[model samples]
Target: MARDYDSQLLESVAVRRRRMRDALLFGAQRARRSTDERLGKVFAGIAIAAVLCAGCVGWSFLQATLAQQKQQQQQQYGTPSAQPSSASSASTSR
Candidate 1:
């Protein structure tokens, strides 16, 4: 009877240790999953910010090009001359 009791006690202790190990493993896995989810959100935010910055840069370049074109057109056409023509000399000589 004592031998049987000793065997039962050993079995119970072994079972308890197994349960503790399983619980610890489950907790570790849960923590890892949570960490991964947080990391994913952080990476996504970074990607969005990068894209927005790129868009702003592109817009600035476009605006600068348009302004340059407008200035070039103005320079090409120029403003009307302010001086009068020199036709009076030819007409008087005729």
Candidate 2:
């Protein structure tokens, strides 16, 4: 008789615990506070504009550096077109 009462008590406790878990799992599953969707779009637009501005600045710097190097090389070796006759003679000899 004591063993039967103990078994019944354990089964009832187990059933109550299961019901509490099920209720918590499937209840009040929505967000408590919501945010503006436009905030995300504004951030995205700013990110894209920053990337474009960086690209433009980088391209201009590259062009200026290349131009400076070309000018230095021209000063060191002189212009190739400065002596047309030598170029023609070299080509003809080859």
Candidate 3:
């Protein structure tokens, strides 16, 4: 009877140890999953920010190019004449 009791106790201890190990492994898996989710969110945010920055840079470049073209046009066209010269009018009247 004593030997049977000892065997039962040993079996119970082994079962408890297995339960503890499995619980620890499950907790570790949960933590790893949470970490991966957080990292995924962070990386997605970074990607979005990078894309926005790139778009802004492209927009700025386009605006600068347009401004440069406008300046060139103004330089090439010269200013418009506001009024006729007096010397030409006097010669035409005579």
Whose TM-score is greatest here?
A: 1
- Candidate 1, poorest ten consecutive residues by summed lDDT: 79-88
Clashing pairs in 1: none
| Whole-model lDDT, model 3 | 0.84
Q: Write the per-residue lDDT of candidate 1 for residues 68-93, one digit (tens) a residue.
A: 99998887666422212345555677
Deviation from native of the Cα of residue 49 in model 2, angstroms: 0.3
lDDT of each: 0.83, 0.80, 0.84
The better candidate by TM-score, 1 or 2, is: 1
Predicted structure 2, TM vs. truth = 0.46
- For model 3, residues 1-94, the per-residue Cα lDDT tens digits are 9999999999999999987876776565776766888999999999999999999999999999999999988876664332245666767999
TM-score of each: 0.53, 0.46, 0.52
Candidate 2 per-residue lDDT, tens place, 1-94, comes to: 9999999999999999987775675445323212333567788999999999999999999999999999999886786666777889989999
Worst 10 residues of 3 by lDDT: 78-87
Ranking by TM-score: 1, 3, 2
* Deviating ranges (above 4 Å) for candidate 1: 1-28, 79-94
Error of 3 at 87 (Å): 19
By descending lDDT, how would the candidates be arranged?
3, 1, 2
- lDDT for 43 (candidate 3): 100
